[model samples]
Every structure is written in C-alpha cells, then in structure tokens.
Target: MTAPVAGTTPDRPLVRTWLYAVAIATGLAGAAAVVHQVTGRFWGDLGAYRAGAVAAATGDGNLYQASHLTPDGIALGFTYPPFAALLMQPLAVLSMPVAVATWTVVSVVALVAVIGLVLHQVGTPDRHRPATTIGALVAALPVFAVAGHLQVGQVGLILMWLVLADLVGGRHRRWHGLGVGIAAGIKLTPLVFIGLLVLTGRWRAAATALGGFAATVAVGFAWRPADSAWFFSGGLLDTDRVTGDPRTVLNQSLAGAVTRVADDPTPGFVWWVLAAVAAVAGLAVAVGQHRRGDVLTAVLVCAATGLLVSPVSWHHHWVWWVPALLLLGGHAWRHRHRTATATTVGVWVVLVASTSWVLAAPGGWDLHFTGLGLVYSNLYVLLGVAGIGVAGWRLRQPTGPPRPATVDTLSGSQP
Candidate 1:
C-alpha cells in the first residue's frame, strides 16, 4: 500500500470521525430517498420483475410475455430467463410498496459492499486510513449512476457485486465460479466472465462455472420446460425483443453507437465484427494481466469487455465504471504520475457529468446523438477501449513477477 499523505497522521482521529459521520449521513439520505420513492408513483424497473414473478407464480400467463407499465404508462417487458422469474417469486408475495422498499435497501447494501470490495481490490482497505479516505472520495464519483439504478430498482449493482465476489471471493472454496454461474442464469451477460476464467487459464474454475450454468438451465427446464425451450432455442438471441431501441442514447455499447449512424439492413454484422475485435484485444490484455499476477486488473478488464460487447449495455450497466475509475486513480496516485492522475480524474468527471440522471432528463433524449450527446452516449464504450489500451501499455513495460497473492488476499476480506 502507498504511504499516507502528509499531515493526515496527526488528523487521523478527526478524519475517521468525519468519515463515519459522512457515511451515516449518506445512508440516512439514501433511506429517506427510498421512502419518498416508495410513497410516490415511482416503482422504477421493479414493476417488470414483480409482474413477471407474479405471472410465474400464478401460471396465469407466459412469464416472458408479461409486461408492466411504469407510473408514466410506458410498457416494460420482463426480458430475463424463466429462472429469474422463479427467483423473484418470493418478492412477488409482498405488496408492491413493501417489495420496493426491501429491494431498495438490499440494492443499497450491495452498492456499499461493491465499493468496499473495489477499494480492497485496488489495495486500499479500511485499515489504511488515508487510502480508505481517498477510495471513499473516488467511489463517490459513480454514486450518480448507482443512485440512478437504485431509483429504477435496476439489478445492475447486485449483478456487479456477484461478479466481483466470484472473482475475488473464496479462493480456497471449490465452487469459486458459482456466483458467476448464478448471476449468468439470472441474466446472460455474465456468461462472459466464464470465458474470462477460461482465458485466464483457470480451467477447473471454468468447468465449474459451465457446470453451474448447466444446472441452472436444468432447473429452469424442469420448472418450465416450454419456456426454457423457447428461451434457449432462440429467444435469448433476440436482443430486439428483449431490449428497447438500440439507437437510444442510454445504450453505450458498440452496437448501440453503430445503430445510431448506420441504416443497413443488417448492421448486426458490423456489431459482430467490432465485438470480435474488442473481445480479442480486451481478452489479450486480461490474459496478460493475469499472467503478471494482477488478477484484479484482469477481472476488471474482462468486465469492461463484457459491457462493451453486449448488444444493449444501458447507462446503468456501466456501474462497473466505479471500480475501473478507482483502480486507474489508485495506480496514478501510487506512481505519482500527475498527467495520468489528471486524465483519470477527467474521465470520472466526464462519466459523472454524462450519467443517466443528466442524460436521461426530460427532453434530453430528444437531443439524440447531436454534438456532445454523441460523446455522452458512447462514454462507457470509450472507457472500455481506453482500459484495453492501458492494459496493453502496462503489459509492454518491464516489471518483475508480482508477489504471490494468497487465497485470503484474492478474496479481498479478512479471514
């Protein structure tokens, strides 16, 4: 870990007290926001999930066919697997308000845990007061996106935490890939992480992830054979059916950007070519980082790749940018690279300024891909590309092999 910044030692107690106060204040504010949201007409995205769960539980209709309107009456479809509906069945039993409140609290906690895990992965655990303070401040840069997802009751943050835990958790445990498998079962994007494990040469872990995913499919099949057949056979590949307009400013993936500019009968071919290039380049960087024993960096690189390659990576899905920013800032800080640090901070400013809270404001979508709107819409994809560049550059530099990280160290938690 890097040394504490000058003068921080004498003020350690005061700083700790201030941090505790800030944490409590933030939590209270978030809780109050949740309360207001529940009382008001905003159920955000939870309506879709809850409606699907209700359909599944009652067997009243096709789970995939169920759609719920927002308070504004915009119909939202349930795009997840049948198994996801099954998983959400318990929440379906609760009243809407209760379910919303419960989900908000759980998502908030998951967000906090993700911040902690990211900080630890970047070598800034709470035990290091100065580093922890810096991490907290840096972590705040992505709060806008996180809070946006929370307001919508989106599952992005929870999915992010699951992937982080699977990468950094339970190194000694046999089922290291179980979390990734389960998350993938709920939403298919996480299946990329299994490829990541394979690329990093964790063959056993890769096999375990594959097995777990198979188990999830089997369970879904047993529970709803027709739905499973429909989804697995073709429905899963139909991005247009699952997600909304690909040209929407909210989608930050390569396909989204291409869709905004192209009028081809099959623009998907362009997307596939771009995705192939990104996957090869990004995975190469991740594999290099892993070989160098920087597992955290490798994991993050793979995550960014997943977001970039996915057909419709919503602005909320870029929540992984939180950790990516922290890791880059930490690297720059530790190396005392002023230019790099400035660039890192500049990226954070850009991302935060372009958050869904800002870009998705009333009438903002009307702006489309005009001028600065283009930059804002494609920010996450650009960031992912930049990450790949950084990884490649780092791989070329000369350095000794990193010290072997223990299972506990990889887990990012105290034993």
Candidate 2:
C-alpha cells in the first residue's frame, strides 16, 4: 500500500492569492478610517501636501535642493539616484492626500508582486499557496504601520523587490547586475549587494553595479548640474540632519534603537561596529551559498542581515522581511519535519499578529495592553535575534547534495 500523507494540500496558490487580496484591502480600508477619525489628520495631510508642494512648486528639485543643504542628502530621500523623482514629481501636482494614497497602492502592489515572484521561484506548486498566504498576512501588519510614508512615493517596496530579483535571477548574471543597478540607483543601501557580489567572485556583477552607479551619478549631474553639486557634495555625505528627526521611530534600526533606549549617548562607535560585523558576516554567508543557486536564500539572508545589523530599521521596514519569512516558512512547511519550518512559522506568526494589534492601538489603552505591547516588543526583538542565530546555524550546516532535477516537459529546463 502507498504511504499515508500527513496533511492535505489544498489549492493553495489560489487561496493564497485571495487571502492576500483581502488582507491588503482590509489594511487600506482600516487605515483610511483611522486617518479620517484622527481630529488633526487634515493638518497632517496638509503638511504632507505642503512638503510635496514646496518640492513641486519651487522646481523639480525642491525636496532634493533642501537635501543638498544637508550632508546626508545623498543617502536620504529614498537615497536613490535622481531618476526616482522623475515619476514622483508629477504627483506633486495632485492634492497631498490623493498623491500619497495613490502611491501607497502602488507600493503595496509592488511588494506583493515581488513576494509572489520570489515564492514562485523557490517553492513547489503546493508550497506556493502557504508562502503567498503568509506573505500577505505578514505584509498587512508592517505595511499598514508604514502606510504614511508609502503614500509619499517612497521606494522601499521597489527596492526590496529588486534585491530579491537579484537573488532569484542568479543564473542570469546580467539580470542580477541589472536588478542591483536599478535598486542602487533608487536607493544607495542596495549597493551593499555589490560587496556581496564581489565576495562571491561575481566580478562582472560588481563592475556592472559600479558602472551603473557612476553612470547614474554622471547623468543626474549632467541633467541638473547645480542640483547635482548640492546633492552629491553636501546631501550624500551628511546623515546627522537626515536622521536627526525624532519621528523616525519606524526605523527601529540599531542606531534608532539605541536612540530609543537612551536619549543622550550617541553610541556611534557601537552602531558602526555592529553594522560592519553584520555586513561582513552576511556577505560571507551569501558567498558561501553562491554555488547553491537558491535566489530566495540569498535575498532573505541579505535582508535579514541588513535589518538586524542596521542602526535604524523601523517596523515598516520590516515589510522587507516578509519574503524572508515566507521563504523560511514555505521551506519549513514543505519539509515540515527535518527542518525547523514549523517553529519558524510559529515564531513569525506570533510576532506579526501581536505586532499589528500593538501598533494599531491608540495611545492610552489599558495598562494590561500597554504591558503586553512591551512584552510583545521584547519578544519581537528576541525572535529577530533568534532568527539570526538560526540563519547562522543553517549556514554552518553543509548544503545538502543537490536535488535531482525534474525535467520540465514544456520548457526543457530542469524544474
């Protein structure tokens, strides 16, 4: 007799797609109501309009022009190459609320699409459903918290997608560089992936990324010489003014966390040490796994490492980790036994479910809720630490022998 299966696999992909559609829709609807309920929301919305207005009214470069006055301008404002504003400038003409709302939709869509693409790449057909479902579920919580910024045409989702693309398209080295270039041009942090490519001996990728970086800078400066000067010399170099704002609580990065922990001590040295160590360790892991050709693993490793090691990751930024969670969760569910996928899934589910409630709660809730939020936050941190530990453990374990490839009857490629 055939061996009995443990769990039934339903039509997971369709179910997953449907679940996410509902979850994201619900999040948007809820946020709209919350924004409407806040008495001072109009004022806040107006403020956003004014910023974009100031940016659009004065010139194409107003927001950027302001950044040039500061040192970190190069790194802030999406820290992307100048081309990012190409699309955003038009939004300036619309009412602030309209512009932001439209952009949030785009970001949400991009995030979902990217995660879906990654899931398809790494998962078996049966696994896709759960992976996508979990992705949507995790995304709803973090994306809602960071909804305010998404409305402003921020590129976090886009950047995260591009990075994931790099890992997924590893077999196509050119595509890897292209994704990295696009991401770096949109945001500087993704350039860190260049370091990873180099460590992996993908010299071509490094060269392509570097060339793209230089080319964009050259073209951006060529297009607007004055703005470029301000952006490069002053804006790119300074982080103090860019990061000084107290409202950037969502960053929740190491630097931001330190700031939260103590109002005074700068702790600059500690933050640098931590970031450097993370980058080095993470790059090492990615390079070691280079031969595996698992794009999902590379992307997750990079993102998780960045969040854990960065000094100022906010909860919204956690949205980037959704794919990582899904990948881990899907892998676990697929294996279900030998791997710690179930444990990983449980950890992520608890963290995400609790986080949404705490984040969405209006201030002055009961002490019990407040206490629970604190406990949950602590739990979130611990899980993050534990995740890094687990990833490190997985990395140390030898990569299992390659699975036998099943020939795809349609494409002739190995599935």
Candidate 3:
C-alpha cells in the first residue's frame, strides 16, 4: 500500500475554515446589497428567477400567465415548480448584483461540496483527496456546463449538492429522502433519485422522498393555488413549458438529436422508442453498478438518463457531469495498464471536459444542419448514449475489480 502524502488531511480544518470565512463574507455582501436595494444591468436566468419569486412573494402578476421581461431585456417565463419560486423569494429581495454575487458564491460552495463527496464515494486516498477535489473544482471552471451555471445563476449546483449530501455524506441518514424531495420540488429532474432509492431497496427513503415532494406541492398550492394548479395541470404534463425549439443544439437530450436528425419539430415516435431503450438499458446498468458496489456510477447513470429523457437539457443542466468525469478519471488511472480501456476512458474524459465542439459550431443553432454539423450539435447527446453503453459493458465484464469505496455506508446509516 502507498503511504500518505504530507500536508494533506492535516490541513483540512484550515481549508474548511477559509471556505467558511469566504462564504460568510459573501453572504454579508449580499445582505448589504439587499438592504441598499442595489441594482444593476446583469440580466440572466437569475433575473427570471428573481422576477418569478417577486410575483410569488408580492402577487404582482400571475405566475404562469405570461412571461416577464427582465432588465436584461428578455421575456422569459419562470420555468420551475412553485416551490422553487417560493424558495427564491429571497432573490426577489436582492438586487441584481447581490443576486449574482450571492448565487456565484453559493454555486461555488456547492460545487466544492459535490466534488468532495464524489471523491469520498470513490474512496480517493485521504492524502490525495483534498488536492484532487480542489484540482477537480478548478478543472471544472471552464467546462461549458459549470461556467454556464455560474454565469446564469442556475440552481443546478445547489440541487446537485442536496442529493449528494443526503445520499453520500453519511451525515443525514435519518433524513435520507428529504434532500431529494426538496430538490425535486425545486426542479423536477431530481425526481429520478427517488426511483434510484426504490431500485436500491431503500423503500423507506423512497417513500419519504415522495412524501416530501407531496408536501412541497401542497405548499405551492397553498401559497399560489391557481398558479400551482395550472402549472401541474398543463405545464408539468405537456412537453412544452417555454422550452425552446427541440431542434436547437442547446438541447442536448436524445429527443434533441432525434429532432435534428429527422428534421422534425416533433420527432414523436422515434424519440420515444430511443428514450425507452435508454431508460431500460440505463436503469439496468445503474442497478448492476449499485449491486456491484459502485453507487456513484449508479447515481451518474440515473443523472445521465434524466438528461437524455428530458425534452430539454440545457448545457448548465449537465452540472453532474463533474462527478461523472471524476469517476472516468479514476477508472482511467486504475486501468492504465490496459491500453484500450485506459485510452478510451482518457479520451472520453477529454471529450466530456471540452466544450469547444458546441461553442465553435456555426450560428443558427435552431436551424437544420447537415453532415459534420450534426455531429457538432449532437456531441453531448451522443456522449450520453455512448456512456450508457460503456457502463453496460463494464457491468458485464468478468474482471474481478477491486471493491468500490461505495456510498453504501451512508445509505446504510439511514434509519
């Protein structure tokens, strides 16, 4: 066995303290901005969230009736659950600068937490753990998904943190499903975690998740009855809830790729067939990984499945890809002696981290493209598909791999 590295775990408390000080200072700055009613022209997705919360908090307008224009000059609707708006009421109180500042700070903290938890899940050596997580966080800085989240003040980071903490932290076992439930309330994507809990035979936690979700819906209805009713009745049921054209490269879902390939505004039958295949195959692989003591892989498979199945998966929505890449890196390192597997995983990691394929593509992302354009536009979609295939293959491999440093300890801690 390798010996521990110097000046690593011993300095954790100092690193943690420094992190706390930064967060406190940032929070104080945000509070000052709110008190002074500071304003700026930093319109982005956070503006929509703030506006939605304003409507929800002040009842100035209908939440679902019409899209609201922000200082940034875009008419965007609040495309999240009522509970999310309720949670963001604080943003309604914040100025644009404060909102952005606070959000950036929060997103950074969550990102760090996610990296640490993921490294823990994989049993990264304690000596290398801090540096690895810090390095991973720095590496994530330029990734399109992560950068997009910080730029637009998206909630993806916070939601990812909630799920990982509840499932992998080993600190909240008694309240296992609460975080998943709350995250699902904020955005519907995390609902997949509840299914994961069920599949993993964590029945009590799954029920708690559903129960928590029900409570959120109840709160939404209580606070804004008509808005909640309308949202759940139509917006949640149908595919379109201000989601842009499915053909756009911004949409990295399987449906997005299918629409582009078939040149259909709505690639109905084929999209469903492919989605169904992905769901079955992906879920099976996830279950296999979980049973084989690889809970992080299972979680990532579920995350990737949600991205593929959703009608719209914006670049920022791929935040969980951070952890996915970490796992891929670990796998590549362990299998370095095996040329094919190592090279494949290493190349895949590069592809996953590089955002240039989509960034450098020609304009008119919504318009149809031929030949190489299709590859550029559908890069992430294809990656998701291929990732599932790779996972399935790994599951079936007969190699007696080392037992995973899985999250079962955390799960088992749940009462």
Candidate 4:
C-alpha cells in the first residue's frame, strides 16, 4: 500500500463544502421555525419600543410615560434610554405590521452576522478548510437561542454583534470604542466593554467609549430634556421597572439565581457581594488573557462576567456563549491530549444542550424552580462561573517562554 502523502488532505475541501451546506440548511430551518412560531404577530418588546418611538417622533406624551400593550394584552412600557427611542424614530413612520416585519428581518440578519463573526474570530485559519468547516458547525449550536431572540424581535443579537465588531475591528481602527459606546447608549449593558477596554490597557478605546456614551446622553438631553432627566435621575437605576422580576426563570444572572433562592429583602446585598467577587475574578482572568496575547478569550471572559453581574440578564442575552463555545471547542479540537479534548468538548455539549432546553421551557418570574428546574434556571450563570474557572486553570498551567505580548487579532495562519 502506498503511504499517505505528507502535508496534504485531498478530501478537506469536500468536507468543508458539506459542512457549509449543513450549516446553511440548518439555519434556514431555524429561521422557518421562528417564523412559524411568531406567525407575523406583533412582538411584545418591540411593541414597547415602537410606542416609545412614536411618542418621541410626535412630541406626544413623555416617551417614558407611554403605555403600550403586547398583542397578548400584557402591559409593556419603554425602559430603554432616550437615545434608544430617538434611534427608533424611523420605525415609527411605518405601520405596526411593517415595522415588526422590518425589525424581524433586521434582527435575523444580525443573528447571522453574529454567527459569521464568531466563526471568523475563533475558527481555524483562513487556509485550513477542515478547521473552518468545524467552526461553522460549532457555530450552529446556538441557533435555537438566536432564533428565540429573533422570534421576539429582541435586541440581544444586535448588541452581541456590536461588541464583537468593536473587539474585532478595534485593533485596526483608531475609533474602536465607538460601536460599544453607541450600543451602550441604546442599552446600558454594553458599557461593561468600556471597563474591559480599560483593564486591557486600551486607554484610548476606553476614552472613546466614554465620549460616545456622553454624546448620546447629550443628544438625548438636547432632544428631550425631561425624558433624559427622568432616565438619568432615576429610571436607569430602577432595575425592577426595566426588567420586571429578577426571580424570573428567563433572568439567568447571578442576581436572578439569588432572588430565586433567597426570600430576604436584603438579598440584593448578597447579590452585590457575589457580583463583586465574580467581577474581580473574571476581570483578573481577562487581564491575564490579554497579557498572553489572547484578546478574544479575554473579551469573552469579560462579556460572561457582564452577564453574571447584571441585575437582569435574559436568556437571549447569553448569546455571548456562541463565541465562548466556539473558542472552547476550537481549543479542544487543537489540543494534543485526548482527555483534555474530551473534557472541553463535553462542557460545550452540556452548555449547548442546556441552553436549547431552557429556551424551549415555559418560563416566568412567578415560577419557582425545583429539582432540575434549579439547574435549568441557573444554566447561564453556571456557564459563566465555569468559564472563569477555566481561565484560572489556564493561568496555572506551565507556559512556554513568553512571547512579546501582542493582540491576537484572531487573524492568522491555522494553529
């Protein structure tokens, strides 16, 4: 028998094509499922946004005071910043059906873009067909969660893309922090990236983020002074008003878990303590990854930390896990040790499976967890904790002679 030729894999391209075909097919199916589930109905959250936008554009009642109802008759109110309402003014010009359809399409596109971004950042080198194919397949694991967000016209996917774009483009752009700032203006969660930038010694980017955020605030104040004052003076701090109940099964933040288990009026204190510890440990790991030239990993760590520390993190907000899973899976696929590979891939499998299950389950703030429900409700927070633990473990491992710390733009030859 002839020996296999070295440095050649003839079937690799064929395998890659097959993988791409499967991923595309699966994504289309997921989109179909979302449409079937939603059936072109008005989205509850998007209704609130639309109402706010209409109010802002018409100079009617205060945007914050505008009351909207979901198709199901649930009372919904605008909870985002004044700038978010201003940004939605264009949608207000359209009829309800048209606005919902347009927003849904945009959201679906953003979801696809997020998947492509993760694959590009964590997949094998551009020259490695097999690795890239595997990355695409891994990227599909979170499609169900993405579809859930799309069905409701949730903004999580767009926010995820904004953060990823900033991280991916920051190395090449002078004003890298602008995207993050704009995203934070729309929703405060993305402000966490600014802290990550500061921790990573990207002071210029941090300043840019602050400036962009300030500009948004200024625009809001100039355009609608009373609404801007309402948000900044009190609305922003009223998590209960913006997010409903922390005990909601959909809220997977550390605070949510605490709220579920603790009945004390002072549970907020406990959450604060836990959040502080998580922030310190998670940010420390992020700093270490940055110093090791693994900027992507560091960013994921910080993103996960943000989810955990937030007062309310809906299940869709955990979309950051898409990139987290890809990064971990890629590392596992490249490792030399079978045991390590199995363990890493096992974690990815567990997380992906659990996320799908949770998204499918009936969830509400009034619901209480028992038995498996506890695990299901706390899945994302546990994943965040596990990610931080993995970072700490990596820090302890013996390292080769340190190469000069340089950003891993996540663009290079295959490992």
lDDT of 2 by residue, 231-308 (tens): 677676566534554223344455554443444336467668867876777666666555565545655666667776
Model 3 scores worst on lDDT over the 10 consecutive residues at 406-415
Off by over 4 Å in 4: 1-42, 127-144, 263-266, 336-366, 398-415
Q: What lDDT does model 2 reach?
A: 0.54
Worst 10 residues of 1 by lDDT: 403-412
Better candidate by TM-score, 3 or 4:
3
TM-score of each: 0.85, 0.72, 0.84, 0.81
Candidate 1 deviant stretches above 4 angstroms: 1-43, 129-144, 263-266, 356-361, 364-372, 400-415
Model 1 TM: 0.85
Residues 56-85, candidate 4: write the lDDT tens digits.
998987888886775555677889889999
Model 3 global lDDT (CA atoms, 0 to 1) = 0.73
User: Per-candidate RMSD vs. true structure?
Assistant: 5.4, 7.8, 5.2, 6.4
**Per-residue CA lDDT of candidate 1, range 165-187, in tens?**
77764444778888888889888
Candidate 1 global CA lDDT score: 0.72
Model 3: residues >4 Å from true position, as ranges? 1-43, 66-73, 170-172, 335-362, 398-415
Return the lDDT, model 1, position 174. Answer: 74
lDDT, candidate 3, 224-333, per-residue tens = 88889888987776556556577877778988899989888797999899999888888888888878867778888888998998878887888877888777777656
Q: Pick the candidate with the highest lDDT.
A: 3
List where candidate 2 sits over 4 angstroms from the true fold: 1-62, 65-81, 126-153, 170-173, 245-249, 260-265, 338-342, 353-385, 401-415
- Indicate the worst ten consecutive residues by lDDT in candidate 4: 406-415
